[model samples]
Target chain A: MLLTATLSLLLMQQAPSENVDWDAEFGVEEVERDPATGEIPVEPYEQNNENAGAKPFTGDDMAETFGGRDGIRQIAERFVEINFADPRIQGIFAGHDEVRLRRTIFEQFCYILNAGCDYTGRDMKSSHEGLGSRKADLNAIVENLQQAMREQDVPFAAQNRFLSKLAPMSRDVINR
Target chain B: MTPVFNHFATCLMVAPLALLPMSLCAQEVLSDTQSIDQAGTFPEYNAKLLLTNAVSAVDGASGGGISNWATIAGRQETRGVGVQAHVTAVLLPDFFYQSHGVALGIADRIELSYARQNFDTQDVGAALGIGQGYMLNQDVFGAKVRLFGDVVYGNTMVPQVAVGAQYKRSLDGAVASAVGAAHDEGVDVTLSATKLLLSHSVLVNTTARLTKANQNGLLGFGSVSDDSYAIQFEGAVAYQFSRRFVLGTEFRTKPDNLGLGEGDWFDVFAAYAPSDNLTVTAAYADLGSIATFTGQRGAFLQAQVAF
Candidate 1:
């Protein structure tokens, strides 16, 4: 009788259940890009134009200077690219979603420059949380952005006008 | 130190890079005690926007060409230390003036500075019977603490404020006493406020000083006729032309306690920063007169480095 009991326990251990989900049992969760935006999903948060962090320029002069929506898109793309490649600040951008960042930054700049776009990103404080940005890092980013804008032949004065709108946002962007 | 100025000439021919700290009203710490810029993934570095720290003044502190501002003398932000060195030459019709010094900044909060000033009387020395080529020398030691506010950040209405002290000691005590000076050494107390208006691309600074020095203490402190401290004013207004160029004017009032007709100092200066670490300033200074010699006006050139 003891031998029979031992044989049954061995059979139970060896049996494989075809209906079982091994991944669910192992606690592995998979994330997929949204088919509509081609960006990964983030936590749901309320979005508003205030999330852009500054009031948009009312006139079209700035928009035209930045080459309208097309020019701003190019600038945002180049800015992110430079940051990811820079040795000093690349670590902060590393592991973040490039596609999502490019889209959101473009939206923010477009909305601010009055190039006519809506910002759907989180507020600066929430977005920068845990990223650990410093004053030096902010300056580096500024220089890289300047380089990108220069490549687009943006006037230095116009760039400063745009920067004035964004300069105060440092209080929110830098993690104290 | 003038040799360093030579490097400035070739640098834009060569190379390329603070704010009045965005200090809060409640900030009292000598440094940023908290560990910021460390937990982040960003690499360590020192960088401030161009011309934001201002230039080293005649006294060797971070300021305009002739006026002291509420700025620390370094390129550091909130995390680390920085330093600056400067050499200034002022050529007047009757006198030759030069100053050189170095300053140390700690955590963008406190500043310590030392400068040596030499005033060459030239022909006027012979006229005054002090021997031709007579040089009046003094060492100026300065310490400043940022009381509150920021030059670059925060509300535009708020400005950076600082309190400082300068101790001036003349090396020629006997000559100074023989010339009717009450003392050969003195202290200057100063309170300064500065702000950068971004929208206007302008910077403004004002300082109130309590001092008893004659010709900034090179001619000695006070005179036998009037040995009392006087309230003086220093003011500067700068217009930013670009990230690298600044045009400004400064006026500094001095105590004429020596009663030799010392004139208030004035200068119209143009400063260019070829890179973050290098700034070259050239100005036309009108010193009015020194030691009864009239029309002391000419060129003032200074080269400064910060890191």
Candidate 2:
């Protein structure tokens, strides 16, 4: 029986299992497919990886530094749009109110930017208590937000300022 | 006595490499490398996660100030490259150790690092006839690559594993020879595993190193009595108190190959990161008998920057 158990353990160790390559699986290629010559594909998350770009914004007040309320609105809109479509994280948003989500996201961003906006959403830890969110899912959302800020032309430093405030929320949002 | 010199020597050798990461961070210009996605976001510091990227140790691999860790260097993943530099100083009662190092994280898969150590023998130098406050120096170049699993978020039982090597050379080879060492240069290889239980906010690392150096190459590589490489074990456990603060303890088992009476080493440490671009670490270490001195206890501090 001991020998049989040992053999079983060895076989279990060698068994094939799911191996998700988070990088390749969640890369930019899938969302930005090319047509015609198919050569001018959009730059993925890697090539444009500058958290603090040239002429980057520098200051403690991120909202005003990033074009004030208008910039936050644009970034929030784009972030919501992308999150709704991102396959990696879209499933978690099912049955939720899109309008409420958008408003919540905007208010949260404003609060982080210290724009004097009040966030009425539930506490992050409690809201995400049973979402079954994983690191991969959270990473996908952060990437989406990054893409949104990039599209809005927010300075890399500005983007980092906003993200830095948001980054800590991971503790509350993941697998609580 | 030899251990004091060894520690001091390794610290100086690591200094220059530590300067590179900060310079890289300061010199970065977005216009030169600006390739934004359709949504206009450029990828930066995309590999691993925040605070997950530890500072380069005295040995030039990512981890605490002294122990080597299993995480890759830098902040980049396969989509980008990351670089970090660090400087560490340990002030002991009998001697001092200073090290500078830089590490590169490639695609979150591999890590390459180099460090130099400088050891100041202080008054102990007079007894050894090397001169008071005599300094010894050595250089270490190292590389590590991830093998399997993920430390932060893997569903499987397999821990994140990495294997690396450090090539060490003593600049003061004459002093090493005088101390009855077999050689002044040697290579130390290590296999390390790390796992993080995110739910518990805990991280654990275990490393096995094959080395021939006495006092981490401060007394040179190998001894006249036993010149063969021996295996050593290192372990660390940390609890994440917040997004930016971690408290931990580390223990390293050493080989008693030389007459220096080298014993195990232990430390209690705290690491804090105010931002992704910077980190600071402080620790209290108990480095058992080195050479003739017993109870080499001291404070350790390290500052690191990465991009």
Candidate 3:
């Protein structure tokens, strides 16, 4: 036992310390570089999309699956109810407009589902730019979304299919 | 003593067989939520935490590519029981090495593992006058318990630590004795520390092993030339590129007492988890030298299933 304790201490000492600044270690610039100036090159979104290939969901498919626009609306309402009640995510809605928020969420889901809904809500990046959202918050929303879909009798496969399409949006909503 | 050791190894091999009936019994008592995934209402069966835990290593302990780590296998749950099985194949230039094992993780604390390794000497056996296609078999039983700290949310400076031991016995005792091995059975104690720097999406683990094994007990334990326990180090660093993919490299130091010129091992690997229950790892390993043969480099493939 004493030997085990000594070896544990030695191995722990071998690990890298927390004080080392990784950003500095990698020589990353403290200031953000603009891509237009080519200081920090950013890959074109089109190229990224090319690698990702075509998305599976389409307006016609989503429209048929959700019974056109009405089913999407029902899903939206139930999602809001779950979000308001879920402690993990309820705090994010503390000061939001209930009716408008529901409408926005409904439109967002419809658009992601490619249900041919003319979503009038703000763009995803702008809407979530300053909420200090983390991956934890996004995960909470996903959990609530799953619960809402369950209440609405959505098949597990269908839920996953929808989520796969929407999962990429995390880059825009989290840690922005 | 040898007969008793063989009996113990046999018992370890049969333990998994006994677990089958118990697993079926437990299934009968599964909660409604546990059966939700089976009913096709839930897509995920295990939903504790993401990428916070690692799959079982070839030796059946939770770790990186080839080295044992401090973290437990399966998803991160404070009070959950998890079990995993793995099949690993390492293709060397002059030998084929394979290991199959099962592990049990209890309440995110204790880990018990058993692995059986087979080393096929291929052409080397003929050259060494040990008969054609001679094989070496060994059984390793490991037990580890987390001692302190949490890798994911530990104090800024401390890493998660665990203390473990592996009792290994070679089945080919006669052949082991011919190779000048001092003993056919030996025990190894290990201390492992692991840390995940989520901020940088990097994972690191360090382990120190106190052992007398030669070539991981395939060549047997200790030797006529050296009989004391030797300290070995294994280290790994991985980058979590995405939720499902991890790219890593490992370095493990080995003793050079067996006169066969065994050297340290290194590998670069990529592990992919399609789901919480299934993982596949592919690696290019440079095992340095084994049995006097130089540059034993080859590919490694491992597949694991956990619940």
Worst 10 residues of 3 chain B by lDDT: B22-31
TM-score of 2: 0.60
In angstroms, how far off is B128's CA in candidate 2? 1.1
Off by over 4 Å in 1: A1-30, B1-45
Judging by lDDT, tell me the better candidate of 1 and 2: 1
**Model 3 docking tier (incorrect/acceptable/medium/high):** incorrect
TM-score of each prediction? 0.82, 0.60, 0.58
What are the per-residue Cα lDDT tens digits for candidate 2 across A17-67? Answer: 579666686683443324553333322433221211112224446667656
lDDT of each: 0.83, 0.73, 0.73
**Residue B183 lDDT, candidate 1, scale 0-100:** 95
Q: Runs in model 2 with CA error above 4 Å?
A: A1-176, B1-47
lDDT of 3 by residue, B1-307 (tens): 3333343344445647776333232222233324444445423335333545586666678887679899876553444577778899999989999999988878778888999999999999999999778999999999999998766542435788999999999998888789888999999899999986654567899999998888888888998889999999999999876557889999998987678898998999999988867889999999998988999999999998877
Tell me which of candidates 1 and 2 scores higher on DockQ.
1
